[model samples]
Target: MNNQYILLPASPLFIAFSLIVAFVLNLMPWGQMVGVPDFVALALVFWNIHQPRKVGISVAFMMGLLMDVNEATLLGENALAYTLLSYFAIMIHRRVLWFPLRTQALHVLPLMLLAQAVQLVIQLLVTGKSPDWFYFSESVVSALLWPVVSVLLLAPQRRAVDRDENRPI
Candidate 1:
């Protein structure tokens, strides 16, 4: 008989930390100057691209709900947009995961746009007026920031030669 133990990856505590940081960033007093992009969304996209199994739809939905509570928006507005975006992320996760960083940015940019569009539609339906165009501008900035955030948050570790005991010549 053969015995083996299956090990699972640890839960992403960094993702939870990122969510809190995003909320704090959102709450900062920018005051119509130095517009802030969606930090949470960027973080989510980064994690989903790197660790979809750990940061899947349920995580996005819960984070979105917290965002709504912090931002004091409608209950389900961000939740719905986030859930849909997460679903889209998961569906393409395999391909996106393997893409070069630049190519992944190209793919994710449009998805961010789509998520923003969904949020806009929901806002229009609920509030009966469009938000300032600057709100949409965040999507562009967020997309542009994805690569930087991905590198900062998910860059692969470079093992030292001494750490690679089994490395072959």
Candidate 2:
């Protein structure tokens, strides 16, 4: 059995569960710390890449609205960033899935950076203030964490190592 070629269809329940978990992680206090990755954005990109039909722009928009409310920032700030993230992720999903996990991380880096840039631009326009340079580090850290996030999120979809000869998928 070739491990790379076989995977169970992702369960919708698990997908929702992962998104909820990512949202909870975002709600954690560490979010104020410099270089803290946006778990919700990471999860949004992951799901948009892996299950585009299941988690589309509407989901990203809603999640962004949730984040905006939680952070008390401008209401549409995250919504716009995440919507663009979902759009770009979906656009390149086919190409991205062909790469190894590490390479995929490289591909994801720009998307993360784009999202942060959008947020930063919005913040600057609205507040007339710039965040410290370290603000961009969140995207780099999130990209670095990509492979781990990919493994954990994909774990449930992977089949048992030993194949059952009697059963047909």
Candidate 2's clash total is 0
User: In model 2, where is the ten-residue run with the lowest total lDDT?
Assistant: 1-10
User: Lowest summed lDDT over 10 consecutive residues: which window, candidate 1?
Assistant: 1-10
Q: How many clashes show up in model 1?
A: 0
Prediction-by-prediction clash tally = 0, 0
TM-score of each: 0.81, 0.93
- Residue pairs whose backbone atoms clash in candidate 2: none
State candidate 1's TM-score: 0.81
Task: Report the Cα lDDT for residue 79, model 1.
Answer: 81
Across residues 30-106, which tens digit of lDDT does each residue of candidate 1 receive? 77764468777777777776678888888889988988997788997788888888888778888986666678888
